[model samples]
Target: MRLVVFDVDGTLVDSQADILASMVDAFAAVGLDAPARQDILGIVGLSLPVAMEALVADADHARMVEAYKGSYAKLRLSKGASSSPLYPGARAALDRLQAQDDILLGVATGKSKRGLDGLIEAHGLNGMFVTRQVADFHPSKPHPSMLRAALEESGVETADAVMIGDTSFDARMAHAAGMPFLGVGWGYHAPSQLDGARAILNDFSELDDALNALWTD
Candidate 1:
């Protein structure tokens, strides 16, 4: 059996508006200016603490993290699943992939447990993932801790698993875990930055062929 792990933020859903809004609120709450939009996008796959630190290393990261979560929750409450709608064809792609008996679906994300669960529930993706790795239990992306834990829990070797994500962080983490990496073109990072990805999928519609190309090699 093969394991397919996905990154949530940019890969599965387009949560950029909520992310940017909450980030602005978080920084404002702490009397700090938020980073530029591009800069914020650059850290999409990182945990709150890590992202906060990257934006403003000297700021109150703990407070900012809490503020970000609070703001995000409010936004989610007000907007519902539309705030982070699955990209066009995302659900269809996921359904197709999940239907494969030999493929096990999992998620490795920088989102917290509550955040991940809420998104999954709102998007009607409950129970779709076999292994859920959240930032609550891992160091951060590019660390390989989350991917390693997912592999161990699934009883799958690194070679039989692939990490699908939208950032260099995901590619780096897959490399660290000795796993193959697949990148999404519509995510925050440019396709050029997805170093070491076996393939870069332009859209969910191309998912099957991209995976086939990667595994066929």
Candidate 2:
């Protein structure tokens, strides 16, 4: 079977507003200013502690992580899926892929297990993924642990699996795992940053076409 692994935050959904807001709150809680928007976005695929360090080398990462989690939880409860809505055409593309018998869906994300579960529940995406890998159990992105776990869980070969995401982190992780990659242009990273991607799509509407091209070639 062919495996399709997706990244959460900036890939399937657009969570920039909520992520930035929570990050701002987290930095404030730690008595510091948050980095610029682009700088924050650059760290989207990293674990919370790593992201915190990247944003502030000497800041208290633990406090910021908790503060961000607390703030995000509150935001999720108050705003629900509105805080991180799926991209346009995302549902359609997902439904179409799920209908296919030869493909298995999976997720490799930097989100905590609770956060990923919340997003799944909020978006009614329960049972959509055959495997879900999160930061709670694995190293941050650009490491192969999560992708390797997804492959092991799905029982798919590297040659038949493609990691779809918006960040350089995803591309590097896929490479490290010996898997192919497809980049999303609308994600936090620029296409220029997506080095070694087989193809990049401007939107979800081209997802299947891109996947097909990647696999058939």
- Residue pairs whose backbone atoms clash in candidate 2: none
| Candidate 2 structure quality by residue, lDDT tens digits, 1-217 | 9999999989999999989999999999889988999999999999999999889988778999999999998989899999899999998999999999999999999999999999999999999999999999999999999999998999998898999999999999999999999999999999999999999998888999898888878
TM-scores of the candidates are 0.98, 0.99
Candidate 2 lDDT (Cα, whole model)? Answer: 0.93
lDDT of each residue in 49-138, candidate 1, tens digit only: 999998997888899999999999988888889989999999998899999999999999999999998899899999799999999999
Lowest summed-lDDT stretch of 10 residues in model 1? Answer: 208-217
Query: Which residue runs of candidate 1 sit more than 4 Å off their true CA positions?
Result: none
Candidate 2 wrong stretches, greater than 4 Å: none
Q: What TM-score would candidate 2 get against the native? A: 0.99
After superposition of all CA atoms, the RMSD between model 2 and the true structure is 0.7
